[model samples]
Target: MSRVLRTPDARFEGLKDFPYAAHHLEVGEGLRLAYVDEGPRDAPVVLLMHGEPTWSYLYRHIIAALQDRFRVVAPDLIGFGRSDKLPEEAYYSYERHVAWMREWLERLDLRDVTLFCQDWGGLIGLRLVAALPERFARVIAANTGLPTGTGMSEGFRAWLEFSQSVPVFPVGMIVNGGAARELESAEIAAYDAPFPDESYKAAARVFPRLVPVTPEHASVAENGAAWCALERFDKPFLTAFSDRDPVTNGGERIFQARVPGTRGQPHVTLPGGHFLQEDCPDEIARLIADFAG
Candidate 1:
């Protein structure tokens, strides 16, 4: 049996702007992945994938804005949100995350997906798109990248070191700090809800280190393979990166230059920090909704 912990339901009680009912799926033995499935079942699927230290709650605003016209599927990756967490941190890996999401997406039979991914979301989601291009209709990348171990930024280096060495994994404060505007205490508390204590944060703590920052990194070759496929992906791709995120400020240029789909597209730079969803959800939601249409 894989040692796992499921957060108590009470921890997520009365979260601000996150009223969607929870849906669960068995991703592995004794591990159930949770997601928020809202809007009409037959509508176009808009898959919202979140990143490290934050769960689907990070996209509550975006979900609320787009659920009216699109089927919004926001999943809590294993070890985050209401999903089951592996008590042993060593079990987590970049490839494992991509595989877990592959299972989740296949089981759900999500097709014609308009993917909105950020942070680690892009790392894993982009791989899914490369491996299964026909499943996606369009893509919108924000404050995220698929790194193949070259030109790693100083800001990311500092973040990686901090994530590995921080005594207390302050999930809520980390999200707040990554936002351009300050978040309310209640909102911060909601971000903290998924992890009852530090042990549940093993996945978050390991995410920064899992990033492929060098050629020797474990996921480098796999990511390079994905990039090869992405180069040929002619589907619509948009980069709505934010202006204030030091971690990924110049990443959009690389995507636009490399990806065939980015040609002639109106790529944008929104005003916000790394977690632009929180800082500019309405604009981001509108962009996605318009792009999907």
Candidate 2:
């Protein structure tokens, strides 16, 4: 059995601009995934998935903006935010992340979901869409991809090197570095809140390496299979990639080229960095609202 670590409740106190109440779902034995579910339960479900080194707090502004019109559900992927964390990096893997989320989704019985995924959120969320395409109504992929062991970009290569070589994993600073604008102290602190110490950071530290950037990478075959599903996903798939994100700047081209759903969609380039949620929350919310409608 894997040992789990949960951040103290005290650490999340007084977070800036994040006022949503947390709800939990038991995903595995003794493992509870944390999420923020807002708006009317009967409303159209909008699932927001966050990416590396960030949590549901990344979607606070987006949630607030869309809650009035949609059922906004944002979950902190295991090892981030209020969710349970594994101390050992060996406990984390691309397949395991997908399994945990699959369980969470099944338990929630969320159907006809409109997914908004970024970063690793896209990596994992796209896989979920591929696995259960029937459950999703549409998709809004931003700053995320489902790599099938293809070569990575120069920016991603540098990020992989830095993540592996950096002695102290600074979660908040990493997030700020990915944003187009500087973040406030409290906002930075909220990014750092879920991680009380280095021990709570194994998943964050391991996520970059988990990206299947080379043919030898573990999830290459699985992502390839997912791509087969995505190719047939003839739903309204929109690519809302950001302009300034070096890591995934032109990444949307692949989806547009391959996914049948990209045909006739008004794909766009938003103004932000890698973490566009922090840089353009309201715009993202508006984009999602219009797209889901």
Candidate 3:
């Protein structure tokens, strides 16, 4: 797993003073995990996992707001953010993702976690929780789903094709296009903080492509196994999916119907697109804190 580390200047220059303890953990032979560890050491943990294109930076505002009360731990997944970049598309599989995250979590000894997952975060994070349900206290899913491939929205398919065919995975520019509001110059650059170029975007390029479109996908059976575990996961579960985000719209309904943990919970409709944190961090934070109570 020998890998290249992308040292994006904008990421470091702009975020040098951000209020979080940045740490990198050795997860595998060539993979190192980059994460922000903040707030009281004794506070209950809120583990945040991001999706495609964006890194841990996506949670900056939410981290700041909640770190004061909870120990926030958000990691940049291997390909998308400030973590190691492997150029091989073959290296970027659903199995690799779950394996990488599990190794990192085991190394960090993460437990009693209030897991918050969005986008790919939910895809990978739900597998983590389902694999070892004892480690988590509750689960808050926002604009994310653990796909079992019973139905995938057409919006997701369109975006999936775009990511695979693009010459360069412009993390920042693509993110701006998806949002309802125009991003400021600083905000756009902030999203681009991770990758210096296309060389660092293998994870972003392959993540969308890795989503199981049909039950025959390589990891479909594994996802089904996770779903089987989730069928009886009687824990605190809340869904705060956004009203926009065509790609993931109604995904919460699938979880609510199948996952026992989400039964009878209030489903929140937030005002934003796919990257709702960029659109309404304050509201998302409020919902998490309110639900965690």
Candidate 4:
């Protein structure tokens, strides 16, 4: 195993509106994954999965809204938030991420889950649903998808280019750019907390390039297989896409058209940018709770 770095607890101190206690589980040798497990233990599980350059903190407001009535589990992907970071970018891969999350899910024994995933969250979470269809009761896809590399959006293309060329990966600023509204300084700093320095950003910096954008891409076959399963998924599926997210503006239509569960559902276009959780957490949380019902 490559050398891994764990962010000190001090960095996460004083984060605004994110006060949930941190829980850690070992997903790999020398790698510990951090997540927030809140609400009633017996309540139905509502899994909130975040995206690139962000972590469980991205869902704080949403968590606060749902924890009273539902069990909310939000984990920081490896290399983000309180999770252990791989020192080398090469250690991060689409398949590895899926595997890590798959193991984590099985370890937790989560069932009857209602998944709300965005960006990379969708990419991996959708695959998890496909892999363990019986575990998922429903899905709420927000500004997210499982791409089979047929086409690339212009907004995504720009982001791909920028992620590669940028010398320093500004975790917080990158998130702010993705959101419709500017994040407060403290919030932005919270996003940066996981990465004490540039070396800690290896996974974040490499995530964009790992996206499958061609037929021969590493994850294309798996994602295509996932799409096949999703086509047959008869469970409830909702698309709560945002109105201002250029990167995923029209992406929801693809899910609506392809996934059998999406038909006749009360899909909605929410107001905000890519990170709608930041712009309208309460609304999104309510929508998710209602959809899960």
Candidate 5:
């Protein structure tokens, strides 16, 4: 584990109650990527990738439920949760994020993966799948989108603006925004646990800005390439988004329209805000298992 994962917040020490066993894969160059490698190591793998402001911790319930039948490997994307954070903005870019995760995957040598991505997880993970389709067998995306933003709604625009302009890094508010209801005190603290102060929050604070909200944004060309690749992605694909999330409503339509194997699979609208897993983990887990079947 890198020194960066060891935060001043001791509250996460109690997170051992979660079923997945922790492991660190040195993705090289002082980067010790933290992941929960659970269930049988030989079981077919499902790679769960999280989005902005959240870590692999977001998938705790899903991990517990699926680890018994499937090998669950969920990594804290460099800078978000237990992974190392680069205090410098220069280190965090869409291209850089893609490359960094490419290295992370190379270290694991994961094959025949079923990708489970939400929020920015879908953004990054999908690009990875497009880049190396052979490594992944299937994909399930929730409350997430490719974010070409060419055909996105005005609501998304307003939210993008608000996220960038917000002065304080309101981790609690953002997490609670997608939550089905008010968060418990402990859960709120868990979201707030990674940061000792503003310094440790560079990644959380920068995530919203990293999203390509407009057609001309910096990540546009890269996502365009990924989309072109996805157009021909012939593997099983599914979308499980929240009905109430205005930010991503109809986003799945793009995937269904574009991706090859997404034609007949179940695409459901789960109940909750942005963070559907926190609100309704049981349904999400069952749906994912059913997808696996």
Candidate 6:
């Protein structure tokens, strides 16, 4: 364990279009995980998992659109949003993230869940599905993949280099750069809110480097095992990738080919970039609603 930092509550004040109250669960010792729990408690759960350099705020639009029909629970990954952050980047790892979120999921006792995961969300969330396959009913993966240390994309390699070398890790600017549409100054600020200063950005800075793109990476074998579980998953998996995300342009193909649940599914390529939630939230919401129904 390392020294933990929690973003000041004042930093999150007056966020745009993100009105849901955050709920907290102690997932680790002295660690409180922040999440948005909206809609009917008894309604079917639709877990929205976000990726790097983003938080549950990334799913505000999708949560609003789906809250009326389903229980939308979106959690900020331990270091990303309202959750506790570790000042030491070394404290974060692929397996630890999965273990933390797994504890959070189990503590909530979420069942028959419909997961909508993107980016590292898929990396961690898919591992959750693989570990607790019985807890998930279906999955909607968008612009995400489970890499097994085979190879890295040119775009991802570029991102890796930029992330490690950049002097000032601009959280908001990096997010804005990934989206297809230009983010308003406020929305961009919300992304920046989680990290008031550079000290709070250890998790964000290390996330890109954590992707197991080589055999020597830590989670390679674990991701390989997770894929084996996915291959046996037959519960209606869908891939709604975007048209403009260079980093993960055709990443969905492997899931369609390997996962039995992808067969006969209407996988789509939406008009957006890596952060498609920003580009087309309503459409993504509708797709999830229809798919979950």
Candidate 3: TM-score?
Answer: 0.95
Model 4, which residues run further than 4 Å from truth?
A: none
After superposing candidate 3, which stretches have Cα over 4 Å from the reference?
Answer: 8-10, 16-19
User: How do the residues 1-293 of candidate 4 rate in per-residue lDDT, one tens digit apiece?
Assistant: 88889899998887999899999899966579999999999999999999898999999999999999899999999988999998899999999999999999999999999999999999999999999999999999999878887878899999989999999887899889888888999999999899989999998999988889877778999898999999999899999999998788899999999999998999999999988888889889989889887
Residue pairs clashing in model 1 are none
Could you give the C-alpha RMSD of every candidate to the true structure, in order shown? 0.8, 0.7, 1.7, 0.8, 2.5, 0.6
Model 5: residues with Cα > 4 Å off, grouped in runs: 1-11, 16-21, 149-152
Error of 1 at 85 (Å): 0.4
Q: In candidate 1, residue 7 scores what lDDT?
A: 96
lDDT of each: 0.92, 0.94, 0.83, 0.92, 0.80, 0.95
> lDDT tens string, model 6, 61-169?
9999999999999999999899999989999999999999999999999999999999999999999999999999999999999998899889899999999999999
| Residue 78 shift from truth in candidate 1, angstroms | 0.5
Residue 231 deviation, candidate 5, in Å? 0.8
lDDT score of model 3?
0.83
Query: What lDDT score is found at residue 137 in candidate 6?
Result: 98
Give per-model TM-scores. 0.98, 0.99, 0.95, 0.98, 0.92, 0.99
Residue-level lDDT of model 3, residues 1-293, one tens digit each, is 54666665446665632555558887766677789899888888899999887888888889989988998999988876667788777877899889999999988888889998999999999999989899988998988887766767888888987888878777788888877678777777877777777777677787887888787777888998998998888898888888889899887888888878887777788888998887888988888888777
lDDT of 1 at 94: 96
